[model samples]
Target: MSNRIVKSSNLLNSFRYQIENSQKGVLIERKALLSSKNIELHFYETITRAKDVLMQFNLPVIAVMLQGEKTVEMDGLGKFEYAPGESLIIPAERKLKIDFPSASIENPTQCLAFIPDASLVEEAVYDYYKKTDTWDTKSDDGKIDFSADLLLRDEAILQTVNYLLYLFQEKNEHRDFFINMTTKELIIRILQSKARKAFLNNFQKNENRMTHIANYIKRNIGNPISVQDLSKEANMSKSNFFTLFKNSFGISPNEYIINEKMQKAKIIIQASSDRSIGQIARDLGYSDSSYFCKQFKNHTGYTPRQYERKHN
Candidate 1:
């Protein structure tokens, strides 16, 4: 759930030039890398440590950290460390007070601020609601809430942002067209990731039927739970339940069950050093050790034993 910075010779060359010619008086040196009707990408470099530097944008901006670290403070969201392999989504017109604690002439802090057109975001939201028939009820207007900032570690978003950077840095006649297409994908990924976060954060306390089902699954995660059982709990047909659950959380009931079990298995493995893989599988209601191992590897990219070795 982390992003890796994409470094290139072109980027390094540009960064070197900027570092050498950095302004002495300003804390942050801003360079507009690419600008189009639908999107704008700007590069920022800070050559010295500073505190409480204010920044605001007219349009929603996604800030990607490439080098060094920053302590960012927003109105509602307090201070948090913004470092490499992470991103922050700032709503339009929200002011940010940022501190560059590690910036220096030798190692300047670098970041990219991507601003997609407001109309583009609205279009994406409209398309999402139309396709999924799902809305965020937590929002008073039944829309995705962007008033608060969002921190993201979604790799898909990171990759898309990197591609957009590549497009911005390169000299291509079709750059705007490609940027428009790629920005649309990035917007959808952000929306879906935000929706998933909202659902996970509120599912425990929210008294909706979906939250009730989520609670039941969490409580009985070590038991055999099927969509049929969940449908019975929801008092709906199997197909209807499946659609409703997926639409609500962007994940199927069975997939959610597997994810919950995998998360629990990770905890059990990390909490104890003496537990055997077969026993752990059984504890998670997996009668077949081989199947459990397969699922664990598929979900975590590590086998149960490997995960234990790596973590413990």
Candidate 2:
């Protein structure tokens, strides 16, 4: 709760002293894959000044600042900030700088970073994600820019932090299977705790409202339905329904509808090489050929004709 987040300099020294020039401390390249989703808690600590920056040509990383503060610029996630009790996320294959500025001789910054190997995130963690693609689980190339101060106090999330500390400490000497077991548990706790919180926040009441609305829209994907009519089906005033729909899913209802339609349109276009753009557009409920082409071009950045020609 101290605004005095453990400064980067102090934590770095402590991490180095603890590692004691251990051979594993010399790992220039660290990589691991968790049995679970985007949960590779790949940890690294530097005792002396780290001259070379952390660079992975094609790997996604999600870092939890275990201790200290650090400024980083990663390949795809862009400029990011970190301090104790915060998670600094970077996309895979990003080139990043770990600026452990010299604050004082006595204290150096220490850090614990998690790199979500994309394959695992896609296969495991993403598979169990609560929300739809709106959260953008499809790509592992973004940052976790929320104020982690609000999230740090979460007891469950903190417990995972403690678990990481414990695992790394034991890993220093113990080759025991229990270290791996504890490590595995730490990953799962994060998914259930932090990731699940995200899911619950969105889909908690979605079963009836969000799901029903989405399902109805999907069932009528072949029909042209206006926002007012969709609002009526939800039994809420147009404005109120629009507000709630966006709040629950974090995008306007019309945008959501368009996104879903585009997804279906992409599939249809991809599947039948013979289907003309007009046929596909009509099946998807757009009566105006030019309008459909424009919408598709905006959503996908490729006009229907261009898309078909390129893909087919």
Candidate 3:
């Protein structure tokens, strides 16, 4: 909807100190020497007002802003402001023109970039597909199609990164083991973040159309939706949309819509205990509380009142 900057909980303050005190003449430090088998971590500090510096990576990279802000220009995604505590996912071999608009000698722009092997990302996606049992794994190209640019400042991922950075310093026996495992977990988390849900629903080739419709229904559960309107949105005739929707999601469109409504209803009921069941039903587009209660029971084996009672 609108641009929102996410702040990280686990920030690298010590690393910033290291950069500020490090020897001059080096704008950025390529810490390839400190890299592991699948992941490389690099730190960058701009000393001057650098603009339009071209950069491209052979593998997929996740860059986190540690200090100050940057005006970044990239192919396909265009230009945007990168700030401290924000993490950006850059695709393989994509050209980027970065500007250190706020960089200076006293307060330089510092950033950390984590470059992970493409194969690691593919492995994580394959494992997710296998777990879901939703797609034919044999047909998967083993390439990540991150159609949209992702900027994550998620608490969980920040915590994981903090742990990995600490593990990089510790000389323990299972340090690499933990680092690799956490890196894979980070990949999965990025793919499944709510920010990327809409893109994945509409653009991901395997679960494409119906997933889009599913997310659309979920996003607009409070509003009225008609089969005709949904068919139009899917760019298909009513009959064809219904058939394809059923084939993709294994449930009729109406059923899926109602299920989404009830799911939201449950959340609202649990979250706002002061609100009445009738109000929850009406808010979810159910005109009749009796009908809503019946449907809720049929779907979840719990009436609205009972569900509320148990949760409360």
Candidate 4:
């Protein structure tokens, strides 16, 4: 029971850290773009760029054109022309270049750029290359339209965006936490408001035993889980449970748990450098120090001590 509690605590903290640290920019230098503190929500007053404003991105980002005529050419994501009120989901695997040829310097354009926690996209949604069976962006461009409601002048959203903007203007340690936390919460709002309906609908339509177990495992990753327990939970025999769970998640439950543990451990190591590796192993509920170190080495190619030394 105590081991379960310790695992639960470690899992909770590490999961949150992974979600928060999911994005790291290779070329980000400013306090604004460099930090993954909060899902970045900023309303740009607009700047007059050369006829073709080209911005290179190492990661995919989203842009919502609130007010202004603009064109976004996504390298692999696709191209979009934004009118006064519309939104676009910028794919991360491509370089995005936008142009505002007709914008007058006298009246700079007003648009909102929503920098979501890149990690959310990294996990929840698959990449364009692998989405042939899912929502194919090029095959069905009309099916991928973004929501314009989020851009409206609502007081709560406006205030939140404004507060984040001011916070990013500073170069301080607090900005890191502020940026990560804010971005995560904002994306959760987006998921709840827009994406939740479609996902819930899909889940309901396919409420089979396998899907149920898969979904439950995601929510209860830190628990002391077993194939027998999960099989019983789904009212299936052990053999049937193994077949279905593997079929759905592409991996068995035990493999999934180990992967989740290593992922959580990586986040904890990245965030808190002062914690001893033995402490991390114990916190993650590894009873044997040597065993945990071996597992960590197998998964990451770096032992726990090496990971701490390099990451810190």
Candidate 5:
């Protein structure tokens, strides 16, 4: 997925004068709009950078871009651009190196980073799985994969962020209680966006069998997998499995497996310098490093070394 620039809200510019005049020169300067026991609203601004600024957050963040452009290199995902009207979810513990290629004194890059409560996230994820019939209750990894970093702005989420910003401005005894309620609602909207994405992935049924198999494959990617084994796992005959798999995803089961393996390999290649190509190959059940290299090149236009060079 790629970073998207959605329609910006009028409310976003309400603090522009304060944000623009307050910072300059620092790689990724920030101002705290509001900080509570469970919620944090931050204003992040950066000027045109001669160098990249590295950032890491302990908590998961929902970053809403309000002004200017930024090219970000994320851990698993390669470099991408974030601009106004766009919002992205940063998975907890992911490191990012961001560069403000288009930012300058006249037009600085401004954004809102929303750090919601961890317990609220867990609660939302739990409630989503509990209510949704699509989820496999037998699976131990019940949490949603918020790792898909790029999220195009949806009106519902943007509106929630806007409402939260407005809530921060209020000074009343029940402010905390109302903010807590809105935070939970925001969590639900985020979960809804995820659910919508999952739905779009399958395009068949709500409890999409192919989606289930895809998730299963991701979880057991390290193991030796075969079409026959996967068919049995899905409780379908070989022919039926092949047909269904092809219909759900345009690719065959074997191709899909290789694609998933290579995707994992790309992440490893970007994340670590210590792991040899052979080690990554073997970890993905490829016994022959040469064959793995060939497959990697065939799948992605670049070989492991070339991919590393481009990303590093």
Candidate 6:
């Protein structure tokens, strides 16, 4: 997957905003960049280091980190570091306490805040279900509800966000139409990403057929597993299994298997120093070390050795 971290040069060239002198009590400065019937985009920059900064939003907001970092805390979600390339989904009417650990005039904290209209979100959800052919199903309502703040590092979401930022700054007659379309795409991506996360987090405890398949895969991840095996495990034909799995999780069975394997590979590489790349590949059921390295790069944008060096 391509890295979602926006390049500093892109932001500096596209978003040209002059920061005003900080008021007596304000910790973060905000500038309204774009406003429309469906959405609003704001540019925020904090120049001074600060802690326990309170922020409240009446509408559900998506904030993308452009530069610098923060430690964010919400009511139910414990505090965590928010860094560049990450996006946070804050629920409507939620209170957030943020700490800017590194902000200065030379390297101020920068982020983009998006307030999507309720109607816009509804339209996106409708389109998501319609395209997925799940609109008429009673089980899947395609609702966007965040139990806690979601931190997203998906490549698709970040690409859409970068496009939206570019569109917001362009001077064109059809800009609004393009922006609306892109915003809907962003919302759909968020929905799919969030659903996949929820399924992964609860699959161990859930008794659903998909969860059962997931459990089986994890239990035997280091073995040679095939789509036919998964279909048999679910007591369904291969074609039906493929359709149902893709519809439920937005990924093919093979893709999910590879994803899980790559995740396991990352843990193994980072947790121990004794294992070589070839040894790790064999442990993950990959007979060829070259193929494993290629798969790892495709999944994580880093080679095994590179990832180990960077993280460990």
Q: Where does the lowest 10-residue lDDT sum fall in candidate 2?
A: 134-143
Order of models, best TM-score first? 6, 1, 5, 3, 4, 2
Q: Is candidate 1 or candidate 4 better by lDDT?
A: 1
TM-score of each: 0.54, 0.38, 0.50, 0.39, 0.50, 0.54
Error of 1 at 120 (Å): 1.7
86: Cα error in model 3, Å: 1.6
Off by over 4 Å in 5: 1-28, 126-149, 195-312
| Candidate 5 Cα lDDT to native | 0.69
**Model 4 reaches what TM-score against the true structure?**
0.39
Q: How would you order the candidates by lDDT, starting with the best? A: 6, 1, 5, 3, 2, 4
Candidate 5 per-residue C-alpha lDDT over 55-118 given as tens digits, one digit per residue, 9 for 90 to 100: 7887657788878878878787577777677678775677898887776656667788877665
The residue-by-residue lDDT of candidate 2 on 209-244, one tens digit each, is 556678778988877877897777665578988888
Model 3 Cα lDDT, one tens digit per residue, 159-266: 766676776666788877777888888767766674343223322342455555676787678877888878766656799988888888788888888888888888
* Residue pairs with clashing backbones, model 1: none
User: Each model's C-alpha lDDT?
Assistant: 0.73, 0.54, 0.67, 0.51, 0.69, 0.74
Q: Which lDDT tens digits does candidate 4 get at residues 121-184? A: 3333332213333321121222333333222323333344445544555567777776655554
Worst 10 residues of 4 by lDDT: 1-10
Candidate 4 local lDDT, residue 185: 47
Clashing pairs in 4: 37-179, 37-180, 37-181, 38-179, 38-180, 38-183, 39-183, 60-92
| Model 1: per-residue Cα lDDT over 72-137, one tens digit each | 887775678887867777756777898988787677788888877766655655565568766443
Give per-candidate clash totals.
0, 19, 0, 8, 0, 0
Better of 4 and 6 by TM-score: 6
| Error at 171, model 3, angstroms | 1.2
